[model samples]
Target: MFSSIKKTTQKLINLGFQDDHANDVNQKHVVNFSYLVFCFGCFLLMAMSLIPFIPIVFFVSFICICLAFIGLRCNYLGHYARAQLLMPILKMAQVTLLTLFYFGSESGFHFLLLHVIAYSFIVFRADQGFTKGIIVGVSSLLFLMCAFLSLKGVYLTESKQNLLLVSVFFFIAIYFSVVINLVMSRLKSANQYLRVLAEKDELTGLSNRRKVLADAVNIFADSVINRESCVFAIVDLDHFKKINDTYGHEAGDFVLTKVAGKMQSVIRPIDKVGRYGGEEFIILMPKTRLPQAELVMEHLRQTIASLVIETDKGIIIPVTISIGLAPISPEVTRYEEILAAADKGLYAAKRNGRNRVAVSPDFQDGN
Candidate 1:
């Protein structure tokens, strides 16, 4: 039961469902839900207008409802970026003007207009201070025009010449809340992108050593609680420095990228693979026993052995990997202990002969 729960949780993490990984996935979900709400509002407006026998207003509401569905359809069809840019702008304009027409100046509908102005500014960047300034200037000009028209009895109710007063503190509080959220969300997204860069190898696009170590700690914790074994393997390409010397470093880089691709292609999704150092990669497979890990590594070795590379000189080269694997023991309490055992087995493979898999001394069969 615990194992099943662990597997489910791991699946969710892999799917980027956690709050820490919010920036990684689900960008369109919020927008889609918003659009859905707007569609419902459109239908509600249509129904409410029909009760008043308002044919023209009902027609407008029907058109707005259709446009809302169009937005939802675009979102569903994967045109998420376009939907985000266009839908809210259209909806805000439509709702603000329509509500204003129905209810005069002092109606709660003015709050919707306030929200539209806030939306315009919030959707844009705070860095666009000039653009924001222009929007604010235009909005204030329009409000002044309306105030003048209120004297001329347009878009206004009875008392607007004396009703221009507003709760300044309330507006300030709401605007501050919106601005703070926007800033924080932008900062969080930027940090996530930077963190992803820090955790990945630029050349290979695989996890860096730091990320591998982080995964190791998590895997160890899981192993401890679940009593599930994990395997760590140190993989080093044979004669990599020689390739760099004979060919240019570019050709060596070419080989490294290709080898990284191959390693990534052959591994299970649950495994963590990374460049441990120059010419050496580490593989960690949680819930894997030694025998299965060995078979996986052996296949990787054979696959890489037959791997052919061509330098710019039209010279062909074959590459092979030396792998040393060790399964975690119940007595082994630290991640480094498992890593050190794997490293020891790695040296043993190098010493006895390169291009083979070696099991750690303590984990050797019949021990």
Candidate 2:
């Protein structure tokens, strides 16, 4: 039973002190909510402590709860900076109140001040008025002075053993908060890196096959429903295998990377390009007609044919791509249908002699 209670208490602590959004407006709102909730708990504890006749507990808890509420209100009203600033002030007030109850800073309440200083650094980040280093240094010195005075039996008349135990509790709380914040920050960064890897091709840095296909399907569907025009294309390099055989696979990779970069440079931001498979690239252009797509593909083909790749061994490799083009329409609602239609025209371009653009017959049929 005691272990279960301990676990529940730990979960509550973790929820209250998360350290991600002190500087972000939306995130600050969430942190402010957490602070308000923690202050509510403090208010409840104050009610229980009232019987001990220590009026400072009730006074401090009341002030903290009011400040927490004000911070939350400020965040909701788009005053996030104001809300974040309140946290440090609230912690300072709490420390002062605790010191009064303990008779002096020498009563071991100085540890709570250290916790507040570190908490400010975690919450306010660089946006605060003072630097974290200065706040931490000053707080640490104050805590050490209080500790020295306590050792000499200055001011605080309460039991020395009890005050020592309170300092230990404060230390544990502050230590855990810092550790949890570091772990969470690392996890957030790692997740962002993994997301980029999932959506991009490793070699060319173009959209990977899966991501491109998914986006193409959505764009096709939207165009179909809205009666808008979109062109689907398949671009295949001519003699790609022969290039790999003569110049080596390294040259093949170099060719693919350069071609992808060239395509990106020429294409509009509204269009999407992706590596469909080995030696095959896919492009989807929204708000484009058959004639416009033909012109774009022809220009791309001519530009690629003009690019000269000179190997270190002095072998000049001239590359060109055969393009297949088709427009999305009522009959071409599915991405598979569009891809298949473009692919058919692609093979036709190869048959008619590589380095040209071919459009599906259905495009002329007005379907």
Candidate 3:
């Protein structure tokens, strides 16, 4: 029975202190809701602590419960940051209240301060104000001094050993908080690096095929789920194989890298471009129609054809890309199918002697 209770307690700790991450605001709001619910449960536990002391305990619990409920409701109403910030403050207040219940700053429940430290690390993050750090330092020092005064018989404390132990544990809590924060900061840095690497094509610094496909899937899903619109385009370099065969692989790499840079210069931030495969690229245009997507692709094609790259050997490498364009509609059930339709248009561009934008006839008819 005791072991079962221990397991349940561990699960609750995991739910309360874990870091929940997301790329969307809605998901972050959900995380804030989950945290507030945990705070509600904490308030319940605090109320039970004062069971024999009726009215006062009921009032405190009622206030806390109200705060938690308000925070949860505000999440749906779009006050995400406020909801996130309030829960931690509520937790810190609870810890502060526990500290006041014991004399000489000695209480076994003082270990609960660890939750405050963890919450600050998670919520405030590195870029936030240092006020949390200041609070922690001042409170810890005040508790330590109180413990010392109690040992010197200047204050009340029936057990010197317990007070000393609690004081020592408080300092230990500080040490653990610092260490954990440092480690988590490192992990967050490493995570950011990994994310960048995953999204970029290492050789040319363009978006990779995998990243592009992921974006397409997400964009398509969002479009269908929300009844939004988007367009997909494929660009393939004209005579790319001949260039590789004529100028050697190094020259080919230089040409591809330069072309990617030119494309990046002209595209909008909301538009995504990726190296789809050898000598080919794909783009996703959210909230764009077929005509708009075609115009954008035409501009990109002309820009690529006009730009001339001068090599170290004074060789001017002239290049152009053939583009196939297709807009996603409600009828298209899969991203891959949309891509295939674009590929068909791209093949037509290649057949029509390249360096131009070709729209899928199938898409036009459906539209």
Candidate 4:
């Protein structure tokens, strides 16, 4: 009975081991749950604070609580995008306006209003800032005026002149918030673009060696649980220095770009190709086996051998590459071991000839 139960448990474990797919799904669920809990907490805080304000505050708090609960539940139950989008709209424009009305714009809870504009700034960064600015400016203006009127006891039945003044202030606040968020969003995008360019090789759109190594360390961590096959191939341009001397550095750059493009074309969607150094490029193939990886490298070799790069002298240069394939199974532990093996294979390919494919002996038995 013990042996039978152990076997059954092993089967169950296998079912749960969906490799990388399971990890992605579980992490997303956790994020969704956390968002729900946060929204619920905000609602609870508002309700507790306003419960003592007779029937008027009590009724308003009750409605806010219901809306919050609905948003929380929806977010928790797989309607993630809908919940994220709808909750801010409901909270900021609907219940939030009411909250501002009771507490005033200068109330301690005024910071909550910033969340709406901030979320918009991040998610809608691509949208026209002028348009978003107008929308937020208008929304803030309306919110501030309503709050002012509510505090002055002219909210429900207001004197016309007083209402006009309140409306003007509301528009001003909205306009200011929109302008601030738009500027912030533009700055954020510019920084991100600059960072990407800094880490990338200009000639070949591949990551520089520094970025490649950093990304490799992160990828290795995921390999522990996923146990998926990872193949690392080191490719060197044969006679690269000769190409540079014979044709010039411009020709060499042309060869490099063409090689990088060929590597990108042959590799699978999940694979990554990066410029490792002067004439060396690294190809990282995730969840791929030796035979599948070899097929890709072979294609890269042939593609490079066939490429016609246009140089500054108006000469079309032809180039070739030598590739070394090193694969690690789930059983492998050390990242360095995989890299060392690939390097050895690359050396072997260089020794054999300028244009050939070499496979590491360590990964041969799939041990």
Please report the candidate that would top lDDT against the real structure. Answer: 2
lDDT of 4 by residue, 1-367 (tens): 9999756643432232231322233323222332343345445545544534334545655665577566556654656555445544654554355444554443323344554565455433344476447546755765565555445332232343344345435543654564455446546666677899888988899998878877676666666668767788899999989999998887788788877887788778887778988999888877777888888888888888888777767887778889888887665677767778888888888898769888876676643
How far does residue 196 in candidate 2 sit from its true spot (Å)?
1.2
For every model shown, what is its TM-score relative to the native structure?
0.61, 0.56, 0.54, 0.55
Local error of candidate 3 at residue 317 (angstroms): 0.4
Selected candidate, larger TM-score, 1 vs 3:
1
Better of 1 and 4 by TM-score: 1
Model 1 scores a TM of 0.61
Candidate 3 per-residue C-alpha lDDT over 275-309 given as tens digits, one digit per residue, 9 for 90 to 100: 99999999899888777787888889889999998
Residue range 183-289, candidate 2, lDDT tens digits:
47656765776887898999899999998899898889888788899999999999999999988999999899889999888888899999999989999999888
Best by TM-score: 1
Residue 52 in model 4: lDDT:
46
Q: How does each model score on lDDT?
A: 0.69, 0.72, 0.69, 0.64
Which parts of model 4 are misplaced by more than 4 Å? Answer: 1-160, 329-331
Q: Best to worst by TM-score, what's the order? A: 1, 2, 4, 3
Candidate 3 to truth, TM: 0.54
Off by over 4 Å in 1: 1-116, 123-127, 148-195, 311-315
